[model samples]
Target: MVDSSKTHEPLLVARGITRLFGNAYALSDASIALCRHEICGLLGANGAGKSTLSRIVCGHLPASSGEILFKGAPLTAGSARDALRSGIALVAQETSLAPDMSVLENIFLPSYALPGRLSFSQLRHKARAILSELGHDHALPLDIEVRRLSTAQRQLVEIAKALALNADLVIFDEPTASLSPLEVDRLFDIMGRLKSSGKALAFVSHRLEEVFAITDRVTILREGKTVAEGVPTAGLTQADVIRHMVGRDIGNVYRKAVSPAVTNEQAVALEVTGLHAPPIVRDVSFTVRKGEILGLGGLVGAGRSESAEAIFGLRHRSGGRVLVGGKEIAPNSPIAAIRAGLGMVAEDRRTQNIVPDMTVGENLFLAQMGKHRGFGRGHSARRKQAHELISRLGLPTDRMDANLLHFSGGMQQKVVIARWLLIEPEVLILDEPTKGVDIGTRQTIYELLREVAERGIAVVVISSDFEELLGLCERIVVVSDGYTIADLPTSRLSEESLTLLAAPRSSAERNAAFLRDLVAGHGGTAFWGLIDEDRFVCLAVAESARSAPMGLAAGHVYLAHETAIPLALGRRQPGHVTESDGRSTVLTPLSNRRGHDLGWIGLSLPAGSKLPNAETLSARVAGLFDTPQDEKIDA
Candidate 1:
């Protein structure tokens, strides 16, 4: 037992939590504490014992040998009743609600087993009241069955159920994984309210941004043990957290794809015209240029994957025309797509991409059996291919013959990518290519994608990452509400711009098309582009401490780096740019002799900016002088 004499005794505590199955260790000596009114983030790649630890904590699974304590009192593991009675509630990735039961019943299901007779009328009143308190008035019907609710509504029902349990410690497992931004904001509001009410919460999510936004402290687990714990969110970056989790630095997630030179004889790789998939994908038309990396950007359920499936013939299309190299191709069948020189890396890799029980070698070559003389006899060749892929993808070579299920989620995702590569298709569709992969493995996958694109393969990538689109794609097609709203050049894409595009718009806003065009036009500007907080630097430099937009049009508030003085300045601030080579240059707001405040002019006289440049940026900045002194500023 911990020294309870400490004033901040944890509401819930785990000590030496260990769970193992046969020879495979799942959770080993894992322990963490949750304090009242605190939100702790539990982070790790998939299969890093996050779920296992959560299960042990919530009493869903027995700790092989360990103890769970509630308010410093000894508690039993693997007892659902004990956990509920002890005020520990868990909302898993899969919402737990009776499909046929009303939302009211779902929220009060835990307390229904009490000694008193069930009262449906009273329960409905309480459920409605709770929903109202959670800011869901009339949004979710109390009497409506859970099966009819949207994914976000169902998630709220789960949260409401947890809240109704009066749980001291509530665990949310990827609650926003599939939610829209508005839904996510609503959920966060609910969480914030819960925190204010002195309740403890644990949020487990794959999104680093959400973790930073919602969590107070973070605990990162790796390979079954807590590698880092109680790490504060302050002064720490996403790359820092990912480095601790994956044991490597991966701040540089973006990579420029070198365009392959197209010969006049080269054929058009992929063509789709008026493709219509009812209810999910609407009339969409686009062409995948030969050897080009085309990116599809959208929110979840925006039909990015559905379009990919239609292209790959996995899902039925109501109406569409597809052409491979100018030759008309039939649809509604995956085999036809494969035959037409196309391959797909699916979104849900666990179920859709890989055969878990199969060995890595078998999974890699599963789609291409014709290349082998026989199935069993092809092991040697398959092994060679698997070894090559494993090496190329930085996978563990010794685990080539091992069951794919035994590999980590990151490694499994890599295997999924490798499986598709064996087909050597002319056009490849990768949906959420790095879904659950860690930073290091994600880089390897990006490199692999580049290699494939270099080989004259028309790559169509569907990603939820706006930054990724800006990085890997020459152009991005934004999808929303089953419609292709805009096709934007990679030159005009940013995280903020993509967010605005992915979000749903009002009918009037939709018809205007001004926001979309504005985003597409000005998204590529380098605002807030200088700061790289991943590295340790005690110093920051600014020249005159005045601001005007550098690459943007609007002005913003400014602050002195040393004194932290507040000042209202334009978007582009006056600053002395300094490089690591000790060369100091200055940027002064240039106006004509009339002092009309023409855009700022930078001189390579002495220094660089306060932000450090890790790359060989001196030469790049040296050419900035050649740029026109006055560029038309956007309003």
Candidate 2:
């Protein structure tokens, strides 16, 4: 939909850009162009030079060869200050923030480039406005330190800082990596507004759905070279992008066997009951069987990482019970956890997992040391297992002596995961294991986890990425605002249904009240949820004392054929439709002002009960949202 013709002047251009570190080339012959009022997607697998080129364009890194033209003038390489002064900003994937500074101060950090005098009061007001635009006005405290914020909150600060620059050209690197689906929609709306205002934006992410949703053009890099440049996004498919990214037909990323994924009959490997770690983790309970890959899914700051920490003894539990192999372990003792056949890879890899100065081999054996009796540090004892793990992980054993920090982000993650596998723990919990990894490495990691599970190791993966949870996990336990809300099989859930199930409690409570109101008026089952072809998911439900049961429960999924109103659900029409059994149902689609589908609200009546007016029900559903949306049935 963008005017890609030469009529519009390009806002930024980098052609044949190359960068080298020692004898290795990070980028080679990379070229891309950006035009005003357009969003370009920079797509690639890990080690494909996407980050290298982005850093070069934003002046964070210098190119060994080639040039960058910004606004028809050459840019000074490696001069971030100059780039900022010239109206270009980068939202770094690994956040670049003063951890000790307050969110308000960090938002205005770029204001130092201006020649005018500073005003803290004015900057505070401006920061609030910027966050308001991002739909997160009150989520972040101006006085809170960045070090105390969650990963999602910190990413918001990075975005706010870039917005504060009011730059003509802005490059977003994995902006939505930590964001929820609703938050992602909000950011895309912001990007659309910026594009409409004639600003040039380059978005870098491994999420192809998002690229297709927001970008007008695509530029793909493979092995440090540009394979496709400035191709209209409308002319490509997800398969096309994947083929270009990995140079092969990467079919179904999650290709588990068609056999039933339920490992319920296996012995319990890990179980947490009433897990209460004060403010962040409360009332968390779940059981993982041996060889089961269970997912703890929620938005960032929903206490997923905190729950894992508490379970693994990395955090003190105010009240809870953690059981490994049916034996309760003492709280606040990580050593006890390791000896009990438990290993946890924390969310922040650089700080929690990797040691920068240590050799990769040493870091790989770090977990083994905790499990061993300690006179030897366990590296020599686990030499054979270490080599075998590295090989299975597709890591080069020759590079074991190299610094762990020198590897790519994907490789670093692999090393961290491999470290835990070397101990051969019964329960391995990985927090956002593929957070910054690319599609190719992501696929490899998925397969690796499957292999680990096949070895009878219970794998608990905590990830903010909903798709990753749905793909790699057989079952997902939904956590919202620190409570374990829903535990559902992956087969019964859709991304829309999962997002609704994971929505924060305020709106969900409101929806509950709305459903109650509907039930009070019509005297039948009223529910808010999503319906797939063969499955139905309930987010909230209300029923009168005399109401007939619709065979649906809150935060649970059911097959359509198992419910009494199958015919009604199959219709999904705007008006009320009666089933063959004489029950009646009416569904109204829920969407936002920007036309993002929220889900549906349905009212079902008993066979002989008086049905509610379809138009009246639709109107009520529309009024439930802050903004009035035109209701339409999905099918």
Candidate 3:
């Protein structure tokens, strides 16, 4: 499906690229080419050399051996500054912005390194123009400090910075990981504009859907080697891409079928009620049963990680009750939480979990040492168990003496997971466990967690990857604006529904107000939800006190037959359908400007109450999606 004429020339070419880290080859003979007027996808699993090639091209790291050509000339960039001077820029996955600097200063920081008189007013004007081109002119301010912005906002700054350089080739690494659907669309629009302007682009990401949507061609890597090069995206399927990335056809990467049975009869391994940590976590509550995997899912900065920290005593709790094994533990005491059989793998493994100075074996026993009361690095007590775990995790015992930093990111993550398993705690919590890990390693981690759950250890996983959450966990607890908004079975949820449920409370205020208006004007109950076959996933609900009860509540899933008004829900017609109980219900489909399905809005009224015209109600629901961003209803 590749366009033969477009493949004739390349703006940049890399051949036989190889990078070494200590005794291992991070990249081996990896080669790729990016043509002008095209966006090439750099596709690979973690540690598969995608970032290695990108870094070498951007001059952040020197290639051990390779030949690179820019504009048909031999190119050697001694440093990042040299690469920028050559019209190349990389927007890294981990941002490189200075936290203390304002947005305007950070965007023009690269310019400061060059020998030229700087003008603050000109730089601000240029930054504004770049942001406006990316469709985020109003979202980011010029004077605000970078440290105060959320992850997504900071990413926008990174993109705008790259544009300010006027680079012909821009490399974006996991650029959309923190963006919402709307933001993603705007980014794509910018990419389209860049492509039409005859600029070459390299998009490095693990999200295959984005690659298929944006890239003209893809180059896949596995085991530090190029598996597929210059493969046309139009001809490839998801299964084919997965096969190339992991070296095998993986069926259902979540491996949910391997999960153990979890029932109400099982004991609650961890219970958090009314948890509060000012400025982040607020009034969060959930329970995980023994042998079950519970997911904490929400947008970035929604306090999912903060809630986990509060329960594990890593954060000071203003109010909350944490119980492990049916016994309440002291608030804000990590030792008490550990004694009560609770373990946590924090969000940032390098800073929070790993001890880089220690050997791998010693790092594996670090948590066990913390729990030991006898002192003197009590590693001998769990030495045998540690060896067994290491063997099961496929880690080489001979390399146990090596520095923990020498291993790959996936191996380091396994070591961290093994650290907690050494304690044999009844409850385990992992935040973003698979972040920066490869797809194959992710599958292995999934299987390992399933095995741990089967051993009766309750597991709680907090992730920004909604698809991973739905695939790995039995149930999901949605947090929005620092509150546990919904808890539902994974079977009843999808990525789209989860996004709607996880919308910030401020962003969702308009829909809430519209529902309230519907109930107050019609004397009925109004709700918003997604319908999948015979099931309904309710996101929000509002009812008038004078209205009859509909036996439905927010944050709950139900079968079509289980509700009092099954007929109306099953039909989902535009007009009102009356049930045997003399209640009339109407369902109207909701969609955004891009025609993405937001789900349906419903209203149920008692028999005697006058029903609003179906067309008028549908128009009102449509208005919610069509409203301008600046004119949205505030909370």
Candidate 4:
């Protein structure tokens, strides 16, 4: 769709870029060109030099060897400030904002380097305008501390900071990782505006659909070298991109073979009853059966990761009972949890899982060292098993002595996972296990996880990728605002329904308050839920004292006939439908500004009670989420 002939001269160019970390090359002989009025997509697997090149260009790190030109002149930047002054900016994948500072302060952080009298009022006005242009004016509070914002909100700040510089060349690295669908769309629109303004942009992402939607030109990298440079985006397909990224054809990633279902009689491998960790995790509870793969699904700050940490003893629990293999384990002690047949692979692999200074073999045996009682490293006892796992994971034994940091991100993640597999625990909890892994390696990890589950180890995976959760898990637990909202079989849920269920408690609270008002005003029971044919999934419920029970509760699934208001659920019309149980029910569909369905809101009243007009009630439900131009659906 991009007219290549009419394009202006390139804004920036890098040739033969090379970056080395110890003995391994993170980027080698990589070249790219970004022209004005176009968005060039940087495509690659994890550790494919995309981030390395972006950093080198932004002066985050000096290239080991390379030449870069900007505006037809040799560009030399000694620090990030130099790059900023030169009209270059980068929105890093991992947020770089200062947590303790206010949103306003972080947005104008680059301005602090400018030699001039400081003006907080001027900076605040500019920050507000930038956020407004990005369609997040009220969503971000200028005075609020960055630490209190969620991951998605933090990413917005990063974007605003980059925009504040009005840089000629801007690079966005995995910017959509923490954003919702609506936010992603808004970001794309902003990028379009930037391109129209003749600002060169580079989009770095693993999401193929997004690449196809926005990119004008694409550059693919593998290992550390550029495989395909400056190829037209319209000429390539998803398969071609994947092939170039992984250097081979990768079949369906989720290759778990069908297996017999585990009965209810099967022993519970891990159970958390009334799990409570203040401010993050509250009243979280779930059960994983032996050989079953269960997914914990939610948005970025929904306490899914915190719940896993609490269950595995990484975080202190105010009150809860963790049972592993039918025996209660002590809280707030990772050592005791591991000894009790529990293992956890933390979310942040670099800071929490990998020891950069240690050898690959040593990192692999670190968990074994903790579990072993012997004074020596105790690695000798597990060396044979370690070797076997390495072979199974397609890793070479000769590289065992190398530093773990020298390997690719996928290889590093495999080593971290192998460390846990060495312990051979009954329950394994992994948070964002495939966060930065490549597609090919992702398939391998999926197979490995399936094999682990087949071997009778209960596997709990916490992920923000809804498609991955649905494809890999038999059941899913939806967490929102630290509460376990719904537990349903994967067969009965879709990504749309999961997104609605995983909506933040702030959004749910509004709907809950509306339900309460309905009950108080009408003297009946009101509920919010999703309905598909004969199935219904309740999200929240409120009832008046005089109202009769409807046999419905929150965080539950039921067949249409199982509830007292079956007729209303079966026929989801806008008007009231009377049920056989002498209850009158009204159901109204809910949607956001983008027309994304948020399921249905229903009210059930006794046959004799006064009823509000159906049209008025529907308007009230719509009014709850009907913002003028901003539809902040807490995905």
Candidate 5:
């Protein structure tokens, strides 16, 4: 992974890059620098030319006028071949996949351009290893056509393609858009590995939190110009980055309702009971109250989209009870679901939601076209509703007849959500609503969803972004292996805690088994949780000694002073600490081999129970990290 050029200078530098498409400028004076062993974040709003700059650097497009130095040598403009040969690889935002090509073939597509003896067997093995490392051991089928894959699956292929190159300088452009928190962690680990191996990385993303988390320095773009160049990311705040990207201050768009129209106790607008769809979905159940934004949170391919499809009637469900306003509705067809007051913006927009040949207005009222299939067409009323919605949503009234594909991905998603709102359904479900959208548009959509709930419409949002779920929703239902395992309020959750809650059942089970073994060896309750400051978030707990019966449960957050074992929680040292009430405890910190904080594992015993050695407990806890994640206790 080391670059042969052992210079102390930056590995790659693009100075005053400018590109023009006809009379308009796509980029102007945009500059960025990527250094070896460091990740430089390339940031901008939706149309801010970050992608344009990345393409130019990777030789996907010819720079109208600019200078790029790779390993202190000038890079040939607009020559993808030359760039690849020079060890520059880009995982593009808009994928470059051949529809008919298999996943294996598509991953190594860059290789076919070079002269070499083909070894399909070696490439296949490498591809499998890459996918496995990406946490998709059996999810993506190598033989399947790229066209048949989901958006998230296709994104994995994009990542694999770049990794296959083993390039010296890698550019990750919106690489985590479709990946969940769990999967993103895996990808970040790989990035860390590359950085450690002395390779350079340029990470292009709109996610500010991610930018701060993974980047060492940042380059900000505004209106195709570099506003901030090579600034230490740690020294810059989120506000500073936003101002640079948008040329103005942007407040938090994830604003909660000051006075909500409805509460979780008010009324259930959408309820799915014992939902069962073969294969992907086993059993999923949740209830969304009027005016509540409920999040469906989980890892990618953990049956979240499948659960949504099953509930919306897009996928056939073998068993499930759908209820709207206390009345049972059948999961027969999408039209039936719509008629029963359900609206859904599916995950796949191009295939499942949009019609490329139709005008934006036509597609906006597409649902209306179906609901009134046999009845008299109410053209006048439909037009009135469309106009009002357009004004409210700030839609393009001037270009109503324009093709839907003419809009950017962000605008297109906004239009899709608007269409569902036009029908005024009681329940509206959006799957990965912010997927592939930039930061500014993401904020707008968050506001839109908040507004939707304010109007007394129940909102169910499925997303891979853990922070989005915590910010936008009041409650989150965690799905793993197609089952709704934990239902908890957002107040008690953090991105770290939610990740733990959404872990796959097998991993969770292993952790739980480890806890059980600890309880069997000792005479007390064993629990796993994150202990930060005064807040203690429990992820899993197993009790074998009912005499102790610590009222602690999973998916709950407790303050240090409020718990029965307050002394033990407060101490949180490497040894056992006994409380005033004589309840003894042993605590140990746990983390994976990668040095990720997995939180603390503790054992609590009744007043007179013999305490085990602290070192012994630590050794047992270490085993949890060595194996798969332990079970998430049912909330």
Candidate 6:
């Protein structure tokens, strides 16, 4: 993946950058280089020194120790004007365009505000030519007001403005947060044009998919220091990047759910019928079994969130009936739903989820205050419970009294999950439970959900990742444009099938057109793979195994007969089975006597299906069967 277009010297370079805030270091001994025709991604979780570096490079903030060089010339500090004059430009995430001015004026406003003011007509012509060079559609008319433009269109104008300044290095900080997918594609097209035209770019975004999709390389920071650098996009998985950032191998991110213990099977935890919401959802119906994980999947804005809200009494449903544990629940009131043993963790944690100013202890017991003794529990009691949750969820508590705003984004998300976990609801709904959290936190959240479900709680998770739903849910319901398109066991769903079902078009149409072309374009290989409850079908097992599964689980090749098969193991199955001849080649299920498969053993046979040694196989089987089914793996 050598970028041949990059033939110039370093367009910008920073050496030994360091920034300190109070006693804590924000950035230390950091360095970076940018070449014209290359796009570099600055990646890290919140508070990972990315913003600090950006500010330093743009000369908005002075670094305690560091040297910045542009075109081999030493750079000045706190003089943004000097940096701009030197051909540097930065586009912050916050909207900076003038609202009342026309798009053309805003595009050339920086230059127009310079010492020698240019006429409005001359600036408009320059803006138009610059916008055209950046591949922006001129038909939209530059005379349109900035306030009326869409977020994506505004981003285009921002880039056009940069081109007008003839900036050699352009830095974009989370530029596509509010842009739609189609708009993002258009922005990427513009970025490609910039790259081809020999301009350097530095991008900061929370979306790892976008980073890997566009950036030539990435730098990962942790604790104000460069933890990892020079990570190429090629051969990188989301998990790989997460592991580097989080310092752990988060095993089975979507943890296995507690298989329902079939006692008192008549209990109905949640029931919904005739659920209708606008834009995508319409007339949805479903029932969640007690102690089961029900998964919801669909394309973005397919009314999954609406359905969750409607059921939780958060949305005003035109027509819908929500019954919790055999009682008809009312709509449009979250408090009523909570009283009915239902709890929901909304999608956007920043706005709709946690309370930022609250302490960790206060946030943990937010929902359970009414259940405590007296009007409210004493501070000591609440502190005790908060400490317990912190220990159980492995939350960082060195600064427990600190506000949630002080913690990293992942930590804040964990606090949100902990808040719900303390409530002990009968029916819990999680919408994108692990959206911004690191891999380690995601695993913890998964385990926490599984623990809740094991207590006979019905759980529903709405996720954008198809693989997540397939790996965690006992049964998945595919919703498309407000309609229940498919309901099936996790075993019956493959990534291709789920994607096809979740798409806007009918399955037949997708198979005939999109699927045919996708398959052909992909060289007839299913790139996404089948996602089952506990495992996923991987292409080239050897290649996958080489990277090692996250965490301490060691890779192994056990003779299917060598490993022990414990008694009543829940849903965990053995290694993925493949067929060659009539022989039944099996991967030994990694399990304890309690039947919890921790790992797997792979075996293959070329000829007969019969066991190699009937007596030995029988003995092993009998031993496993004799073990008590109630044994639990201490996972």
Per-residue lDDT tens digits of candidate 6, residues 491-591?
66665556545644332231233223322332221111222343333211211232222121111112223222111012233332333223233333323
Evaluate all candidate structures by whole-model CA lDDT and list the values in order. 0.66, 0.84, 0.84, 0.85, 0.82, 0.64
Q: What is the lDDT of residue 389 in candidate 4?
A: 96
Q: What shift in Å separates residue 616 of candidate 2 from its native position after superposition?
A: 2.2
In order of listing, the candidates' clash counts read 20, 0, 1, 0, 6, 6
**Colliding residue pairs in candidate 6:** 249-551, 280-481, 280-482, 281-482, 282-482, 583-609
Q: Highest lDDT: which candidate?
A: 4
Residue 629 lDDT in candidate 2: 21
TM-score of every candidate relative to the true structure: 0.70, 0.93, 0.89, 0.88, 0.88, 0.63
TM-score of 3: 0.89
User: Which stretches in model 4 have alpha-carbon errors above 4 Å?
Assistant: 1-9, 19-25, 63-67, 94-107, 120-160, 178-198, 213-216, 232-235, 532-534, 559-573, 576-584, 606-611, 626-634
Residue lDDT tens for model 5, 354-380: 888999988888877666656776456
Off by over 4 Å in 2: 1-7, 258-260, 546-551, 578-586, 605-611, 626-635
RMSD for each of the candidates: 13.1, 3.3, 3.5, 3.6, 4.4, 15.5
In model 2, pairs of residues that clash are: none
Shift of residue 373 alpha carbon in model 1, Å:
11
Worst 10 residues of 2 by lDDT: 626-635
Ranking 5 against 6 by TM-score, winner: 5
lDDT of 4 by residue, 57-102 (tens): 9999999998999999988998999999999999988789998999
